[model samples]
Target: MAVLVVGGSGFLGRELVGQSLAAGHQVAATCLTQPPDLVGPAWHALDVRDRRQVADLVTAIEPDVVINAAYRKADWSSTADGAAHVALAAASAGARLVHVSSDAVFSGAAVRYDETSVPDPIAPYGAAKAAAETAVTAICPDAVIARTSLIIGDGGSVHEQRVRALATGRMSGVLFTDEVRCPVHVADLAAALLELASSDHAGIHHVAGADAVSRHELGTLIARRDGLDAAALPSGRRAGTDLPGPLDVRLDCTATRQRLRTELRGARQFLGH
Candidate 1:
């Protein structure tokens, strides 16, 4: 299969690109600035915010599947408009689209959300993601909108790095005990996405991990796995703070899990805690 992984330079995108290449697919990737020593997949310069640029690239590649993993927490154009552009381009190219979304779309008022749950975003980032989801769904009704949670790699993820920094007293921040989310491993998420891409499944699918854990507990797990002082990690509460996000948002992946061959293991299992 010919696959186009947008934002191939990102953490999740890198995993998806590598895994797609490993699966013997003809892979092409897009990035703003080219990454050095990137092997296998053909790289293209793309600004997903530019409608014409997105359309031209997808038209030229003519990929069988397009996975969009591009987003900026603060940039609305990149997260929302970029998604719309990718969806339009993919639809124009007659390619299967898998738009990566976030559990942040939910406000966590109900705590646990299923595939049928509507987005009630609170923060700007969550709102951007919700807007992206809306645009993707409207543009490509056949597209799979896979909503995932905190993506963690073995040791390369930003969250893991933060845990290390906090444990080592390098970063002055606290992992909130009140803030909770389902954390999915990058490999599992990438594999599940590919599986969905090859399948006939469409519409919203929750693709998060099996376990929902608080930020502090997750940090402790990371610290323990990395041989850091778990007790040294500072802890706090986001409830009373000025933080703009939900306290607990758990995605129920029961339906999605039944469809996927890939097992979405919990953080405690993957982190080896």
Candidate 2:
């Protein structure tokens, strides 16, 4: 299938592009700044927020699938500008739309959220993403919305920095042991997304790591894996408050697994543990 990846230059987008290319699919990616060297796809200088440009590009490519992974903020957003444009463009081009969403849309109060959870976003970014989810589904009924959680990998993430700080004895604060999260590695997430692109699973789907761990535990594990001092880092509960969102952010991936025909694994395996 010919696929167009909007915001194909970001961290997750890079992984998606690489995975799609490796799967022997025709890919076209767009970037705002530096477009990376995509092996199996042509890179285009496209901006998703600009309606005319997005429309022109989509119409020209006439892609069978359009994966919208572009977002202004990784965590929060108050405006739905980027999301709206992508949805509108996808509808205009008559392509199957796949919108990347987040588990942040949920308040994280539920122990495990399915695709049916009503979004109660506490942050601006979460609110905007939720809005995008509604708009995309309404505009394009065939659109696929994948809501994922904290992304983990070796390629520069918030968790990686924290691990580095403690390993190098540069830690200044305690890790949050109370804040639990299910972090999916970018590579695994990409693989699942590719599987979804070829399936008929339309509507919202939650994607996250199989195992959920507290912030402190995750940090400790990373330290242990790298042969660093796990005891050197402080507990993440210095503030004595659960994270603003759900304490246990595990997702029910039954639908995702059924469609992909494979179970998604947790983030710990990325360290080869």
Candidate 3:
């Protein structure tokens, strides 16, 4: 299978590219700002927000699968609009699309969410993700929307780095005791996504960790894993914050487990006891 991974320079995108190459698939990856550190896959400088560029690239590659992992932190045009462009381009080229979405699409009103849950995004980022999902599905009905949670692992994940910084007194912030999420390991998510590239599974699929934990617990676990003092990490609640975000966006991965052979490990298992 020839796979084209958008945003291949990102944390998750990098892993997907590497795993795809290892699986003996012909891989081509795109980068916007940062260049991918790993070798083996063909790399291209691409900005998914550019519709013509996206269409031209997809037409030229004509890959069997196109994985849309491109995202900009809070940029709607790049994150949401870019996803639409990629999906449309892939669909036009008759390529299978696997769009990576987030649990943030939910407003955290529900304790647990599944693939059937409706999107109720609260933040701008979450809204962008929700928009992306909608556009991808509308443009390409056959596209697979893999909605995952906080990605954490050994590859210097941002979540772990923040916890380490707080534990070491380099950063002063409280880990939320109220905000709960199912944080999946990067390697596990990457493997599942790569496998899904060839799958005919359409619609939204929750591909997340098995365990749902509070932010404080996740931070403490990451601190302990990095040999930092877990007690040093402060905890707080997001309920009374000025700009409060989602409280609990836990995704149930029962569908993912039944569909894919890849095992999505929980953060506790990845970080150890």
Candidate 4:
């Protein structure tokens, strides 16, 4: 099977590309700013925001599976509109699509969000993601929208780096004790996404870690996992502060667990206690 991974240079995208290649599948990857470090997959320069480029690439590649993982912070055109373009192109070309989404799509009003939970985004990023999910579903009904959370693994993710900085005294800000998320390991999420690319399951799926933890707890866990000073990381609350949106967007992955054989382990298991 030929697989096409958009945003192959990104943290999670890179892992997907590598895993796809290791699984002996023909892989093609796309990037905008930085080129992918691996040499196995075929690389292409792509800007998903451009409809023509996306269509042309999908037409030319004709991949069996196309995973839309491309994202840009604070760029609606790239994050939201780009996802629509990709979904349309994939649907037109008759390729299966796996659209990566975030847990931020929900406003933390509910105790826990399931696949059927309605999106009530409060922040700009969350709103954009919700819009992308809508566009992708409307454009391609068969596409799987994998809603994941804070991706951390092997000391490379942005969340882990921030915790590291705080532990080392390079940055001085308390992590929020009120804000909670189901932080997933990048490798586990990547594996599940690849598996879903071939499956017939469609619509929104919560493909995240099993445990829901607060931001402060997550930071402290990362600090301890990396042998850093966990006590140095201070804790804060999101109740009174200017922080926007829902404070606890915990995802329920029971549906995902039944769908795939991959185990979406929690941070405590992956990072170790």
TM-score of each: 0.99, 0.89, 0.98, 0.98
Strongest candidate by TM-score: 1
Residue pairs in candidate 1 whose N, alpha carbon or C atoms collide under 3 angstroms: none
| Candidate 3: pairs in clash | none
- Candidate 4 regions exceeding 4 Å error are none
Which stretches of candidate 3 lie above 4 Å from their native place? none
At residue 267, give the lDDT of candidate 3: 82
lDDT of 3 by residue, 1-273 (tens): 999999988889889998998889999999997676788988999999999999999999999999998999679999899999999999899999999999989998887899999999989999999999999999999989999999998938898889988999999989999889999999999998887877778889899998899999999888887888999999998898886358898999897789999999888898896
lDDT of 2 by residue, 1-273 (tens): 898888888788888888888878889998988887656678898766677887888889989899988887643331266777778888887888888998778766676888888888876677888899988888888888999888777746677777769767787777788777788887878888877878887998877888787878788777877778888878756234643444555678776776676467776666556
Off by over 4 Å in 2: 37-40, 74-79, 238-247
Clashing pairs in 4: 108-246
Q: Give the 10-residue window scoring lowest on summed lDDT in candidate 1.
A: 30-39
Could you tell me how far off, in angstroms, the CA of residue 239 lies in candidate 4 after the best superposition? 1.7
Please tell me which model should have the higher lDDT, number 2 or number 4: 4
Question: What is the per-residue lDDT of model 4 for residues 66-158, given as tens digits with 9 covering 90 to 100?
Answer: 999999978999999999999999999999999999998998888698999999999988999999999999999989999999999899999
Please write out the lDDT profile of model 1 over residues 137-212, one tens digit for every residue. Answer: 9999999999999999999999999999999999999999989999999999999999999999999999998889
- Alpha-carbon shift of residue 191 in model 4 (angstroms): 0.6
**65: Cα error in model 2, Å:** 0.7
Scanning candidate 4 in windows of ten residues, the lowest lDDT window is 237-246
